[model samples]
Target: MALCEAEKTFVLHGVEENFRIDGREREDYRPMELETDIVSHAFGSARLRLANTDVLVAVKIEVDTPFPERPFEGKLEFFVDCSANATPDFEGRGGEGVAIEISNTLSAAYSSPNVFDLKKLCILKGKKCWKVYVDILLLECGGNLFDAVSLAVKAALWNTQVPLVKQIDIDGNNVEIKVSEELYDCRKLDVEKAPILVTVCKIGEHCIVDPNVAEEQCSVGSVVVAVSEDKFSTILQTGTGSLHMSTLVDCLQLGIKVAQRLDAALWDTLTLECYTCSTTEDESDTTCLDNPSGVVGGVTDCDKKYCIIVRVDYKDPRGKLASILRSCVDKPTYTNDVIEDETHRVYYRSCRTAKCNGGSGRSDSTSDDNGSLGDKSTIYCPGIGDGAVAVTVSFSILLFAYAFVRYVR
Candidate 1:
């Protein structure tokens, strides 16, 4: 929607005052909701809702011959489909332009080996490699599409589980490849150096990190910076507006700072998401929304950085609240953010990658108010049966019974 002269003035004044229509500061971003593993058929999948803009990402893997020149690296391709329901402009081919732009941007951002090590995907040099197809569906486009797309792509890749190649047999010019059939016996992509894209909008004498639809309409130009760790991987300028060299420098600085914080938060959320969900083959297990290191038989996405420990001292009378606890909750993850009790102590402890939920890292506190992964016996784990399946199913049920409950009244 085009902003009227008066509306543009209003938005301009807000930027000048450092307060946006949504009460956000210049560098502030809209609150975002991210969920992973939404696509079961795909190797990895994630759905992210940044305010009104919603994006769904799914990863599909296929075995194919590598490029002759770059035999050591596999392939990564991105496809974006902008749903017609997102906006009036997207009703037809109008959205294709936007889709292609985003697709190309992502392509460039991940083009470098230093940014994403595609070599890890190679199964056999010059013969076979895994091709990862990241399919993105844009359900809504509230604004700031580039930033939202980058985040969802990173998360989906993090959740992806690449099938392990067991062996290969070659006869003459024909090549035969064998892949591991066991589920979860797969290699996960290391996204520690994945690039994150941040869009900085230039308004009247000011720049903003996340520009809403109206704010975006009023902007003269925008610069998108893809930050990889502390380095700038790729930068693009959009819109007809031009930036002075000094202005461009400022934008890059802002993009890096925000991207760093964004990377941290993205890692935290990914770790937190994997922590709460379990991976047991049983489809009937109670879905754990937040347990980072799931108990036995549980499915866990072992993309670890910092593990979160939740200590719940059962203060209620024996079996009194079990029935009630099983009935009144709805949302992802059983977190203190949902249930607040003085006895609950939640601590984030740093841990190694791919370790299960029970592995303890360094302790954050020692007293009653603290907990660590090392004190497993001290932590909470409801026993099911001795078998891995039994243990996984039983633990999932007791762990997240509250997360599935909804207040009917």
Candidate 2:
């Protein structure tokens, strides 16, 4: 579908005015829908819909030998499949090129040790480890596919529950291992440093994030940046046009800023509490979202403000002490009225639990109970980012965020 000269001019004018065709700002993303644990057979799974683009990711684990050179580390593999249902052009082997590109991008993003700690998956020092297979299915291609796929992968990894190994026995060259039979006794992957991909498209003179298919087609050039922590793990350029060094730098900075906000929003969605609402038959018959307390299905109030603060104290064996404190608050609030609802899960393990404050205004502090800290070790579980919760309203459904934590020496 090609845009006419008038349509392209209109889009350029819209960008110049800082308003997009969908009325979104330069950095704004389309309404998104995310759901986790959808695949029962897979170890972990999540499905995400960003407007017309749809993505599904599943995680599978297998026992295998570790790499000879890096025996202590496990393996992570990514596989992408572009379904023909999305478009006839993707039928048979037509989509293979796109699938390979997406998969390679994912592999590059997760290639760094700081991004994902593979050592945690090691079952034995040199003999055995867990192989993680992340399979992605692309049901639709609206645009900004890279960003949508990365988000889905992160959500699926967050939902993954790796079984705990109870013990290991060795007889001759044979190695025997025992895994916990209890379903609840499992550990979660530490994805705090997992990378998120952001695609920044350069329009006439402006760089925009989350470009729709039409916007993508009109762009001169684009860059896909993989962000983890406060740095870029991988940066790949797409499209044919080239950018000046200054323009490239600006795009990198913009990508970082956009990725930070996106990361925060994702964490907020994953940590939001279940919002309960009541509705009558009449209310259901009419528009439920219009009423303040009615229903909106997955749409939520992005205007609602919230804040969260977390403090963690770590004491090493040498008596060195370190404290990590983080906090974030919704300052002015977003102008968007409706957003997709997303559910998140958390697990906590600690000797002394800290009380949390709620709502728009909150002031809380961590307990100074160092009495139990002298003789025993303590593990404190922290939320993904600043731990802020998103405000939500939905129709006819109640959802709760679950947290599970395990203690180990």
| Model 1 agreement with the true structure over 105-132: per-residue lDDT tens digits | 9999999989999999998888888899
User: Which ranges in model 1 have alpha carbons more than 4 Å from their true place?
Assistant: 273-409
Give all candidate RMSDs, comma-separated. 14.2, 16.6
How many residue pairs clash in model 1? 12
User: Each prediction's Cα lDDT score?
Assistant: 0.69, 0.66
Quick one: RMSD of model 2? 16.6
Best-fitting candidate, scored by TM-score: 1
User: Which ten-residue region of model 2 has the weakest summed lDDT?
Assistant: 400-409
TM-score for each predicted model, relative to the true structure:
0.70, 0.68
Global fold similarity of model 2 (TM-score):
0.68
lDDT by residue (tens digit), candidate 2, 1-409: 6898888888877887889998877877787887776788888788888888899999999998999999999999999999998767799999998889889998999989999999999999888899999999999999888999998898788768899999999888889889999875777787767888999999998999899988887889999999997899899999889998888998999898777667656654543322222223233342221232233342332211222222122223322112111122222122112112222111111111111221111112322223331111111112223443333433222211111111220
Off-target runs (Cα >4 Å) in candidate 2 are 272-409
